[model samples]
Target: MDPSRTLVLNTIIKEKAVFTLFQPIYDLAKRQILGFEALSRGMSGSLLESPDKLFAIASKQERLSELEIICREAAIKQFVSLNLPGKLFLNVSPKALLDPSHPKGETRHLTEVYGLDPKRVVIEVTEQDKVDDANLLLTTITHYRELGFQIAIDDLGAGYSGLRKWSELCPDYVKVDRYFIDHCDQSVVKREFLKSIIELAKATSTQVIAEGIERMEELKLIEQLGIVNAQGFLLAKPTRKPPTELALLKSLHSEVRSSVNQFEQSMAIGWLAKEANAIHECTQCIDAHRLFEQDRKLTSLAVVNDAREPVGLLHRDQLTEVFAAPYGHALFDKKSVIKLMDKQPLVVDEQQELDTVSKQITDHEFDIRRHIIITRDGRYLGLAPLRDILKHITEEKIRHAQHANPLTMLPGNVAINEAIEQRLRSHHDFSLAYIDLNHFKQFNDLYGYASGDSVIKLLAEVTVDVCAQSSSFVGHIGGDDFMVVFDNNDAEVLCHEIITQFELKSKAFFTPEHVSAGGYWATNREGQKQFVPLLTLSIGLVRPDLQHCINSHQVAALATDAKKEAKRYRNSYLFVCNRRKPTVSTVRLENAG
Candidate 1:
């Protein structure tokens, strides 16, 4: 131990001089603040002003346990006064916890002094240094948990003993090291590693918290990995007091969400026509004619200007027809190929989305048979054949139909599950609405299975019409159950619209007499005769944020909860979990009386 640092440590310890700063940790699934990690800083103008230096100096002076206890004492006092929401993560190390010289019950005593429950405290075992004994450390952590403190393995995957410690300690939380999170969005390897860690944590029933996320992209990546908890400067910097209101964090989340949308849209045209073939505009008609003559496989050619911009398209059949005419070859054989080319060829930017290009082609009506020219920044790249586009569209339609529900032709459970998983993986913001038809079975029993099929089909049409204007994925979960996943923020609005549509359409599903009666006679579940109302729609809408959702199953669970809440009413209703707001429209045909 250095004599000068030892003296400084002794002086600071005797004075009990240190303060704590708290950095807020966010729950991505719940989309709220989960807690704060208490970071200790030394008094100003001291040899150990920063945590690193303070801990180093203490270790050098063989007073590591004493310093840790003092910092814990101060942090606990401040944390209790602040009354922060969520867990308080206090830094601890195996060596410090196992220190023979340290007071045994001081940590528990510290919590008791402030009237804080030990469960609210998480003893974060940092992994900056190697542990001498894994078994001893695991025993110590188990003992701490038994004392009611939660266990967290900090700096996971950042040290030599990382995996081993994770296996041995079996902490409730595992904090991913900053190294893996940095630039994770840009590196496939890092993303895969993070995904593995998340999966591992899930398998072990341990939560993974991604730490040191400073970029919105990194934050999005972690969310995409299905990681529920994250802490970093992007969310909030360390403050003497952690933020209780989360207004600033909410605003930043909005900003990052916008960025994520832009990033996803940046690659609109993915590898669409990179392998297209082209020809020079200045080529002689005779030359193109000769090439076409020599190569029977050459069907069409893209004519480019000097700047490599596609100016026209020439088809072998058209050229052959022109040359086959009397005096056509003699007069135009030596002329430029531009004379025989179609000047108004369909041209599209390479950056244009495939769907937009497809729509353009579809709208052209007459040009569906022609090749679409693709360019990069006005420079010709290649031509996309009509056959390829048609094939691509056909394959997409076939795939959609393969996963479609037989009755409504909407996507089925397989597609819905896939879409949810994809959204979770891509970190796209969306809400899932699980729609169930109330009193559907009774209606089917009163009328026939055929009438029930018609009702299901009608509901499907209403759902499609309601979600038509928005970017949504509507699927059928078989029978009376359906799913609609919305990408926009106005899901609550859409939910109400769907309910209105369903209510309006409900009248057409019933007989005139039944409509007048406002219901039909049916046997109740208790073996009593009763009047059953027309089918009503119950929608359980849940936005799949990082906090409350980790996978498709979790999202389905939330949707189930929302659906249960909505089904509580006899009329069409919408129940949003996060908003805790229910919209019940008393406008159902069954309630017309």
Candidate 2:
């Protein structure tokens, strides 16, 4: 290190010139801010402005412990002054934490002085240097936990002993490195890595926070992978004073509500939500206890903030356990319910789908007896009993099974019609593609009924696979016909991919000689010997006019007409009936080989 830089560092540390910026970490399911990760930096426009440089210089100067303490103090002081509503995640380097000269109980003392609850502070153990003493680290972490501070492993996958440290620490949160989250939507390997981490987190009862998610696709994939908490520039950037309310979060909630609106009432979790009273987070434990005592049927109560947003959950049993203890009433009755409530209770949006919510509950390993908190736009709505949700999901599954095609297990005509009608009822602009196999009867005649069934199943798989990336609904229309209802505008692109994939996969069903010939001799429907083209898919897409389309029947008729138009092509084809307006009937055709 330069002597001049060392002098500057000494002055910086002596004056405690470090400052902190907070980036909000969001709970995607609850659509609320869970906490803020405190990022410390040096004086702006200085050589040590970057945290990396500041920390590297500190380490080189052998004053890492002192510098870390200074940074922590700055973060905690600002966090309290700003009156941030969520947990404050302070970065604690393992090296500093393990330093022999590092002052013990300093963090607890800081929180006490600032009148901040130690429980609201999460010591994020950063992976900057290798840890040589595992037992010492565990003991130090235990000391923090005893002081009511939560533990989190930062940059989890970027460290030398990430898994080892995680096992040893069993931290409350593990922040997955940005490398695994970057472009995770496009990388199967990264997705698998995230899946493994999520599964491990679930098994261990540890929450995983995906860090550095800068893209919308990354955020979507993280949510799809069942990660509830996330931190990244995509959500919010680090600032001196972070906004409590996020417009992006509200927009995301609106999108979720809109998606759920597309489904029928029976399919959404909102219908299962029962009216339940909520207690303010500031309500005393004694008052909450009395409320529970009055209602024998009430098992739990949602704890909400002044804005009616759910902050936690208070269980009757938990309160009962506390009061049942010796002098428990004297010890805790006057304390706020927030002190006794489950801060990480399973809270879900009311607009979430039943199946999606079910998966979330199961993935989180939530007990069925502990009711889930339901919210609409982050505001308290009601409680949904897990038993009722399971029962509804089971019933829906059975109903769906009955309405599913026996051949491919895809949704059958009843479900298909319902889907179309539901879309039309909601006035959602969607495209319905009627798909048919060209020369299927002749191919079946030559290959036999078993081969014909196989071909139909193949088409179902292809269509479903191609549309899997989107919110499209693929249904089996029976025999050689299939249907895909595209909720997104990429129907044409998906159609082309389906045609290409089916053509490639279907070649396995034909003999090499017949495949090379590209045609087979079969008796025609008129009982005349004729050459029939190899099996090919004919897709007819029709965008139903929201204003003109009255029902699924009309949409089906239009799709069928378009399919007839597509059959005019001798090869695999997609024929689109562009219903841009009620008065216009434009046709577009594309052949796929």
Error of 1 at 572 (Å): 1.9
How would you encode candidate 1's per-residue C-alpha lDDT over 1-593 as one tens digit per residue? 57876777888898988989999998754456778999998877877788888898788667899999999999899999998888899999777887889787789999999989898999999887787877777778888988999999899888888888888888889999999999999999998898788667755668789999989899866765567588989888899977865665566545433433333343244355745557788898998988888889777788987767677788898999999899998989889988888765666655555555565556434355667777664577777777677777677678878988888888887778887778888787888888898998798888899988988888899888878656677888888888888888878898898888887787887889988888889997898998888777888888766554566766777677778888898777888787422233222211111
Candidate 2 local lDDT, 489-572, one digit each (tens): 999999999999999999999999999999888887788989888889889998988888676777787787788889999999
Please tell me which predicted candidate would have the highest lDDT against the true structure.
2
lDDT of 2 at 307: 90
lDDT of each: 0.78, 0.86
Q: Under the 3 Å rule for N, CA and C atoms, how many clashes does model 1 have?
A: 7
Estimated TM-score per prediction?
A: 0.46, 0.74
Q: For candidate 1, what's the RMSD?
A: 25.2
